[model samples]
Target: MHVLIVGAGMSGVGTGVIAAAAGHTVTLVDRRPTVGGLWSPGGHYPLARLQETADTYRFPGHPFPSSVRDLPTAAELAEYVRSHAARGGLTEAHFRLSTDVRALRRVPPEEGGGWTATLVPVGGGGGGKEQLRADWVVVASGRESGPPTPMPPVKGLDSFRGRILSDRDTFGMGADELLAAAGVARPLDTTKAAAVPDAVGSTFNSGGASGDPPPPSPNSVVIVGYGKTAMDLAMTLSDGGATAHVVASRRHWRMPSTFFGFISSLPVLYSRAATVVMPSWAATTPAARALAGSLWPLSLAIRWLIVAIAYVSVLGRRDLTGPVPTAALDWFRQSFCMIPDGFRRRLAARRIVVHAPDGVATVAGPTSVRLTSGVVLPTTALLWCRGAEHRAGLSFLPAADVEALFAAGDGVRLYRHTVHPDVPRLAFVSAYNTFGFGTAVHLQATWLTEVWAGQLVLPPAAAQRAEVARVGAFKRDILSCNREPASVIMDRFYSFFDELCGDLSVEPVRVGGVAGWLRPLSPDWYAGVGAEARRASLGVTV
Candidate 1:
């Protein structure tokens, strides 16, 4: 089978590798000149680091360099991701970078049916246009693909004279350089700024330092969002000498980097045993049924205990409190933030200000922002970290197919978060939002390859749609916060993994006997998953 996988980031590369290993020809395409998606150099904002630890946020077999201790910066992970592709035997011959996939239309049934993709050079180079045909299409181009949702339309925004920047505007710079580029003066005790890398420095500045109008001095920066990006920017800006004021209307529970600043949260949160306490929409597994059916009281006690432990971990940190009370159960359903190291200290020291349950009423003047709470904040740079609007990345599809693929306001209704019940020969990876996304995407790749190769059979379309609707209903009726229509299992990854394994006919539980379940689940445990999948596909008993 010939496979055309769109978006050569982590999802695309992982999918392509699995498909190729399944004895299929795969071509990976992306508009960016490199791989790694959000982790690509210049792809992420300055000073961004992985929210996941180095051990958990990677592909199964490919490990980060020995030197990448703890969480890796965006640049370090990008290099690791690029090497992962090369080591998987994907070279230039299999990639179409700096290219745009304009449209994808299915060939009519009268003729031999397949997918025909229209391609054009990204920057209007010598290549006028091109087309490619593939037996299957995998749109792994993530939902966060297009330009970020523009800043909310607040009153007097146009009249404010100070600089206004989005998360996209600060890509590819060191912390010092980012502060400098934003016209923020460094603290008296700080060291000199490092030279910006040539890749971004050459075209980064449109004015100011290079003979254009000087940028407005950003002495005070008000960041407008409370997601991970907002928290990251708050810490980075505060550490870089600018006072950061965070404005948000709502917030969720944040997991501490470490439990009680001692125990590693990874082993506690990422283990399969942890799923017992998390109420799940997927209650098909034995443990899930046991908890929901016969052991409801036990489950309740354990869940409440988990909530107490998580809540107590951050107790007494007044600066960390949100406008509303957040429970541990809420964290399982909605996406929650992981509190970065030293962030609480920054907030306590008054370097970072939190204005929860408040929004910017207007930009009162060139250097003042009026808040909905009736407070006027002094501001120069207004950094908006509001998350991206989901760009369907399906504009290439016919109108009817597009309508069938997406549910209004909910999200792309994919069965098992991989294939659309109404669509055929098309699958998606990284479509669902979750923690440990790399591991999830890799597993999805393996499962999809087996399914496409006829090694496994999915339920009928009606049944699949019913399951999708069931999960959707669970999210709406039971899950709290209900942030996105696309599923976000949050810390419920273990159950998600189990379901994928059950579908592949492979052992859903990787650990040995009862003792192994206690160990922290690592990506390395599943290193042989693709091989296991291939063997299963060939009907070989292991």
Candidate 2:
């Protein structure tokens, strides 16, 4: 089988490696010039680092070099991705870098059933149209693959005169360089704004030059959003000697790096048993459902435990001011983040001001922004970290299938979050965005390759559609906060992996004995998955 995989990020590379191992011809394409999609230095915000430790967020059988830091930075991950691809025998011939997939559609039955992909170089004029055909297509491009979504038009935004920077504009920048580029005074030199080129991209609005001078005080940045990017940006700016004021309408629960001061939360959070109590998209098997039912008390305790940690890390801070709504934990929302270091201490120290349950009513003038609460804050630069708009690239599919790809409320109608019931010979990995996306994609790609290799079979079309509908209903009614068309499964990674493993005819629980329940669920536990999959393909018993 000739497999054409899109995106070239963790999902794309991982999918290609697995498919090739399954004896398929793999070709990977990405719009970015680099191999790592979002993890590439050019693709992410300044100073971005992995939320998962290096050990937990990696491909099967390949580990980050021991010298790499626990939370590898964007550059480090990019380098590691390059090495992983090479080690997996994915050479230059397998990649189409700086390439744009113009269109993808199924070939007519008379012409032999397969997929025809329209490809063009990223920049126009260098290459004419190129046609590539494959027996199967995998849309590994993540839903959130593009730049940060711009904020809605602010009243008086056009008239305001300060520099405006979106998350995208600051890519590959340092704290001081970004501040200087935004026309804000550097920490050491507050009197004069440093020179920077005009806005880097068409989307970035370098707001008109203001007659009013930049703020002399340090910490002149006002960041809009509470996502991980916003938190990390605030800390980075603070470390650069500027105060960062964070503004948001509401707070979201932030998972701590550890329990108390000494315990590591990674192992606990990575296990399937950790989220057994939390309501999830239902288990497909009867036995799994019964086991979940039997663990209701443990689930309740876990919820309380999460709440207690949130208070200790963020909500309980006495020095903080503002009427921020306590983040709802009933459903695991996508915005749930791993709290950064010193976030609580900075909140208590007033270095990072929080103005929550409020919004920017309008840009008051060149040097001030008026909040919905009627509080006017002096601002030298406005940095928007508002999350990106997720899009399922359906223009490539036929119009009829495009409509079929969506369920009620615009949720993607994907069977097992991989293949659509109406679409054949094509699958998507990491299309349903989730926490621990790397880990999720690794397992999903394995399952997908197994199906493509005929080692694992999907249920009948009717049964597949029914399962899709059941999961869609669960999301709309229970996990209402996750409304992305490609639903965000917030902490539901473990259960989702279980579903994929079950389909692959392998044990979902990697460890055994009593320790399996509490021990850290490391990716290493599944290192032998490829061997297991090959055995299954051979019709051999484990």
Candidate 3:
């Protein structure tokens, strides 16, 4: 069987390795000259840390170094991915670099039963839109492939006198670009001082000029949105001695990675458990009484415990303390936990100032922004870290099936997150986003390859749908579990992982030693407590 995979990043490469090992002829495609997708150094967030662990990112047998924690740098991850491919005997012939998949259409199956794919080459001239028939087409092109979200038109935006930039344009720029753009320099580096050559040079003709008056450092920067990107940018600017302000419409919950000087990898003891216990307060509907009852108090107690321990153990310890008050816990959650405490302390002291309860109402200029609160902020640049949208690259398919399978709110429509229901020959290697459950792509690829090879038979559609629906119900119940006194979100995170593992027939492993056994058991106990609390608080029952 021949498989065509799009996107050479983690998902594409991971899928290729798994497919090749299964003895299937696979062709992986990506627009970049190298693999690793966002993991590439060229990616804007190249130095970013992984929010998960080594085991979570690597192939089953490819264990990451034990010392690695939090998030691996983009460079580290890229090297890790390349090494995995080589060690697995996966070759470059299997990858089509600098190739973009423009469209996908199905042809009659080669053996007269499955499907063949017609792939159009995007950039190179060699494959003149060749149709390489395949048994399956894996769309691994991730969420970031789409065009950068357009900046909302704001009144007076065109009239701003200062320079403005977007997140995509911030890549690879040095201090000189920053200084010039901010209007701090008297003579900009005309030969090579351009920030975004395409956008800046085309408009200002500044790149080739030998001598040009430097621009003034703008007063401030207005960052739009509040996801990881926004936080990261704010941190970067602060670190670079830039005082930047972030604007967010809502208060975001941040999970710290570790407690005191310890690593936060052990889920049983770490702060992440709080997330699982309480569903995201941001969820709209109320959670099922049973699940909600079990999670809320457990999460509350854990959060309190984390705070208490931090204050007692390291709040004043000079070695433990730095720029920010040292908490006995991982300060920032996600994959960046591996970054040293001193750095976080510095970040804290500098204080990445945040503006909450207010979002951008309009962009008056690149340097000026209006808040929903009616106040106006003067700025130099705007960074959008607005969340991502999921796009299924199945546009070529007839509308009906695409609607049924790829439509939003569709339940586990892809088989084990791989094969499509109606199109069995077509598999989607990386589509879903599982928070913190590392190695999702690897696990997905393994299960997909098995199903493709007839080694694992998936449950019938009805059963699969039933499981998906149950998981959905469970997720809803957990998320809406509480309204006030915010419930822990990590507890529910683990529950979701449990459901995923159960659905995939993968055994959930305890991360820590003897203490780890206690983690799984705590869910049931917490469920009972959460149910009682919900009944008391919301008068709800399940």
> Local distance difference test, per candidate?
0.73, 0.69, 0.51
Error of 3 at 384 (Å): 1.4
Per-residue CA lDDT of model 2 for 1-542, tens digit only, reads 89999888888888888778778899998878889988886787777898878887887678899899888988899888888788888999999989988887788888888889999988876788899999889888777665567686789988777778887788878767876865656464322112222111111011211122223353467888877788888776755556677777654455767666657677777666666556678564443475558855665567667666645544343212112243334425343577665565444434456666567889887767887877677777788987665443556666666667764654566887889877887788877756666667778887777676666777779888888888887677666655463466757776787777766777777787757666655777776766786676533211
Q: lDDT of model 3 at residue 288?
A: 24
Colliding pairs, model 2: 219-242, 219-243
Clashes of each: 1, 2, 55
lDDT by residue for model 1 (1-542), tens: 89999888888998888788778999988888888777787778877887888878888878889999788988888788788788888888999988888988888767777789998888999588888999889988886675677777889888887778888777776777667755578752223122211111111111111222122235778888888888887778877777777887764567777766678777777766666556777765677788878988887777667667766677634334432344545555566678876666665445666766678888788788888876677776888887665644567776777788765457676788888888777888887677777788889998887777677778888889898888777766555465564556667777678778778777777877765566766787777776786676544211
- Please list the residue runs of candidate 2 whose C-alpha ends up more than 4 Å from where it truly belongs after superposition: 188-219, 284-291, 313-315, 318-335, 392-402, 483-486, 537-542
Judged by TM-score, which candidate is best? 1
Pick by TM-score: 1 or 2, better one:
1
User: What's the TM-score of each model vs. the native?
Assistant: 0.89, 0.86, 0.70
Candidate 2 residue-pair clash tally: 2
Runs in model 1 lying further than 4 Å from the true structure: 187-218, 318-326, 480-482, 534-542
Q: Which of the two candidates, 1 or 3, achieves a greater TM-score against the reference?
A: 1
Q: How close is candidate 2 to the true structure, as a TM-score?
A: 0.86
What's the ranking of the predictions by TM-score, best on top?
1, 2, 3
RMSD per candidate (Å) reads 7.4, 7.0, 11.8
